[model samples]
Target: MNRIAAPELDIRASADEAAPPLERPMRITILQGAFLPVPALMGGAVEKVWHEMGRQFAAAGHTVTHVSRSHPSLPAEEVVDGVRYLRVPGSDTPRSLAWLKVLDLFYTLRARKALPAADILVTNTFWAPLLLAGARHLGALVVSVQRMPKGQMRWYRKAACWHTVSSAVRDAILAEVPGTEEKIRVIPNPLPESQGSGDDGRLGAKEKVLLYAGRLHPEKGIELFLDALRVEAVRSVLVREGWRIEIVGPWSAAEGGGGESWMDRLRKHAEGLSVTFTGPVHDPALLRDYYQRAAIFVYPSLARTGETFGVAPLEAMAQGAVPVVSDLECFRDFIRDGVNGRIVRVEGESGVADLAEVLQKLMVDADERTRLAQAALAVRTSHAPERVAAMFLKDFALLSTLAVKVSH
Candidate 1:
């Protein structure tokens, strides 16, 4: 296996005046499902978190290698943002295919074999827990970055340390995997500095657009958003006010167990409505444009399965869009009601009306929207990547010590 190592930097202590002595940089291998250097198919928060983590680890005197499934359109291997990337070919089918599953398993095993010697192994999701276990068997310290409260607790217990994106997620993991509380650590999602010019001040003239920018599946609450729009009052307001609904995401029938036929059904239902389906926006700059023009950011996530942490609202908030999200446990952590954004109770169709009311208020009242926008900006600045990177470094150092003790 060819080994590519970036030069190591000195790790400095904040209070010390002198440069810290150089130490051997720890080699870390991060296993992720899908790495989206291209924007279109990067569906969840985990993509951004893991990507940033790898970059930060590399910068902080560590050789970080990230392994994930490669898109059919892209090369099998490429380096981006100063981090080493190894892409394994896999199917993009929405539904699970036996052959694809086998390929994923085969590639993960292959990745374990081909990667450089690593002092630590970090697995992002439950699907890759088995791979982490394999890494542990290789005598590497295993760290599981738990993003959801699924049935992977037993497997994750074998990890030397578990890092969660939010406290709510940590609590959920504890509930499911009792006696593993000591192993869990909470680190919130990091927001990158805003690089684009947002909203061109032409608010009223622009169509009153409501934006939903993740997967168009039921779990993401797209169906709920659509169903809510179908209410008499909701429909009346949108039609009367000339508001348009825009669904910007990768839509496929396989995504929600319904093949392309499912996408056709969604489109058919949205015929008369002022809704434009812009398949997928891969470019961050273009996606930011959608966020800026959007009157309200709605994330009405319904499916409880793997709906752990939401990074979309944070990104939208960074662009100064008020988020109207479902009362999911993950959203409850960052979204404070009437502070930065509004949260509607998740109770089927009723939740939609609650979100609709908030959207309606934001549309008409400029002052309220402006206040929320400023608050959103404040939230975004607080979650800046440099600050988040520092926090992760500190936590990783602490965990590294604890992990060594546990291993001993």
Candidate 2:
């Protein structure tokens, strides 16, 4: 794909030359419980979104601070692409639930004191909303980024404003808390452009690779994907076509156990299959490399319990990989069947049959793959960092004007 440079914005200087007085940049702080440059803590899509938002805000002349739990491997305070990151020390509890609550309290207090006085406090997860509420009390405007369950609606309503990555999430938020329709805004997931040569030559020489890049668990429909692949016809067709499957993601204790035990079960069921489990590839650059090399991106998600937004597919699409997603609310907003990508409906027990059909057809037809891939590439440009940053700045400007009006 041909790369296009992001359009530069004009920023006015402060009214001083000799002294070069410091401009009062909009101080914006983002509160997330878990964020690290490593995969163990921060490989998730939410973390990627947070990082992108921070970079964009800083580029737009805002002093953005990202507050999250400290991983021992990372620096307590560091700057990545101009965004200041502060990682607070987490708790030592063994239990996941207890540790999460403990970390929440720890980071909240730490962030309150450490973060410079900000014009806006943007809380990413539901757990951090209480902290943002406190920030609001301290006279900072609060914008809650809803990415979790409806149970946290009370906290969301307390926010000065709300935004989410998808319309499904916004609807869920409104459903939980009435009269918040106006407060909620939808900004699609901002996926960084793939930084690789768009040479199909690299993929042409290798076996057709179908990539599933995300958490491997029940909600993500990994079992369903494997089950679908187990069908004799599907297996025979894929093997005959020399199509290899790769699953790249971290094992979550949240999905049961994180060790090889779960993987052993998957392997036992996937006997004689050409599947490679690459564990968790944390680096975004490496992940994008996989995206560029893969022939198709498949997301067979069925459950929405912990699935808020579909970021992987967007990233895959950005790299010109055609996405094959399950019929889910979040996916329906962007993926137009037969246009940008294909959507397989999940009905009854036939998990991979519909997906198998779609994949088989896409793998065989070169023209269809190229067309869809191009369309997918086009779709992602709208969600590029600069574009998403402009959307956010527009929203912030609107909110600021509204605040001034209300104050008078």
Candidate 3:
């Protein structure tokens, strides 16, 4: 397929730069999927990202409208934080992934009727790219590929641009559908300012807590984290030193988790460890409190294909917690092994032992932990919300200019 080459995007906007004039604003529409609400009350990563981005876009003098699922508490149509939100009747997340896609298709059909005219239509829904292919009045369709595509990219040929959060996702798409290099752009997620903000006293009073946030799924390597804690060396640190592990996030299959059976299995495995299973904390300000108090954060994800990006660990890093992650290509985009964070090779039977060793080392060495923690704080600026929003706006500007679709 022949494609129009993407224009060079300049996203060098800093804190000192002036905002765009209100008279010349881009009309932007963000369409979220069927499950979560706009304010991200239920803790969906994709929803939270676009929600924050929508607010930032609006603040930067763009006319923004965010269309999302309707919640009982939220109004059907209202403006919050400078962005307009339109909520459509939506369904709860079903058990099966296949069924979820079916619901997304139906929701897209419903949402299509409510969409307003815009210069750019940004969406991460399963069917929006294909469904809105002929929506010329809604302007350019910029699909946010937040996950690895399952042979869906070829059908989304009408998308003006594909925004991927990391090179890992971008490479996965290119591998699945060759000749799509020109239509893809890699933009890292921004660390919400709330996650990075806290008193310096919080950093100084970091506890001996190892934090693990995100869905309680098998692919997330929670089982591996449990197995590592079962190791005698790690158990010694937890028992003798009074160190504790906190496993946070939802565990139901409907909430993008591994199901209740998986959660039960994890609980059984963690019989004697100092592990606490704290459920999902949707509020960013409250989640930041957990990150601020933790001395270390671990995300030993084993999802080679399912894991697109690690947002939880990044938030923890912003709060000055030293991160120890699995050796995933997605994490390499931000985390440099032994510099800002530790990356453990968890590929084989020795994986548990490898993870245990890293945990034990960080648990004992306060100085080394502080060193990595300080360096990890740099993500505040690198992945700052303002900086990443600028990157997206740049791409949106370029794609809007080259709205003519070309394919062979």
Candidate 4:
């Protein structure tokens, strides 16, 4: 087999005394899933993240290419925000997980030929790491594990590095496939830079909206949110104070949501309450507006296995909405109980009371809510796009150096 050609590392110091050293830029390729589009016009967390990161990478003088499913409004191949976007024939999400994986396999095969010559290939796809493990054209395979691993990590041992969005996901990978600790790297997802708006960060000035932004699936605990609303204390606050819950996200299965049947159940459960379903808002500005206007952001996810890093909660917190999340270990990386946000313990079925209590306190106590929201702003700088991108770049540089040494 031919040896991969790694990018040269440039660690030359800057001319200015205050400026940082100039680093080398590599050709970076990011392969997304077959279901979502690149520009994130249809709304997928991974898509939006990589799209933004691709732009950031390109802005820093790196050649970034993002390949994902094609959309009607977007060109099949075009350069946007300095990043080259290449789209291929793709399909809507299937109802069955097995079928989705099968589709992913076919998509991966198609996406392989579309990949340009690159020094580093970053992907969260099911088959990219397996298919391109020994590809001579691509230099380090960075497998981004955004979700929990289910026996898949065993096959991905050959990857140069495994990027886990949270420590919980890294732990899951080790539990399923041990002895890969040296290959794993924990990096939290970054907040979108476009989320910056001139909106007031004051909690008292925000709307009386209690927001829940994510896919309308059972795993996200939408029903549990409604159940919490049904609690007499929460209901009294809503009725007396006129606080409304706005559920935003795709509800159809095609957009990676619980199908209509699940939505029907949610509607039935949410009866006689001040709830509004805004459907799926794909625009970043509009989504940020929802986060901006809301006083509290509630994400009661029960997907212990499926939930990795809570991007929605992070985005909400960025907009100064005090996040109320379930006690999932993935959330612990950013959310601290009663500090930046509230973590309600979800034990089987008993956690609803705890959820209700937290909501009631936030709704009633303005001082406490403002304090948490102010603290949450710390994520803006901590998980900023530049900071996260720098972490990836450092890892890429290390991997490239290692590859060059091995090749020699």
Question: What TM-score would every model get versus the actual structure?
Answer: 0.82, 0.85, 0.93, 0.93
Q: What lDDT tens digits, residue by residue, belong to model 4 across residues 145-181?
A: 9989988888987899999898899889888988888
Worst 10 residues of 3 by lDDT: 1-10
Error of 3 at 192 (Å): 2.5
Task: Estimate the Cα RMSD of every predicted model relative to the unseen true structure.
Answer: 8.7, 7.1, 5.6, 7.8
- Cα misplacement distance, residue 51 of candidate 3 (Å): 0.7
Instruction: Please report how far candidate 1 places residue 270 from its true position, in Å.
Output: 1.7
Q: Report lDDT per candidate.
A: 0.65, 0.68, 0.85, 0.84
In model 2, which range of ten residues has the least summed lDDT? 1-10
lDDT by residue (69-127, candidate 2, tens digit) is: 67778888988777888877654323366666666676567766766666667776445
Q: Model 1 off-target regions past 4 Å?
A: 1-24, 34-44, 97-103, 125-128, 131-147, 192-207, 253-258, 402-408
TM-score of 1: 0.82
| Native RMSD of candidate 2 (Å) | 7.1
Model 3 alpha-carbon drift over 4 Å, by segment: 1-23, 194-199, 404-408
lDDT of 3 by residue, 1-408 (tens): 111122232322355633333445789999999999989888798888888899889888899999999999999999988899999988889987798889899999999999999989999998999889888889799999999888999889888889999888998999998998999999888776633333366568899999999988888898888888888998988889999889889988768888888788889998888889989899888898899889999999999988888888888988899988988888888887777888888879788998898899889999999888887887776777877887888778777767744321
* Poorly placed runs, candidate 4 (over 4 Å): 1-20, 194-204
In model 3, the Cα lDDT at residue 257 comes to 88
TM-score, predicted candidate 2 vs. hidden true structure: 0.85
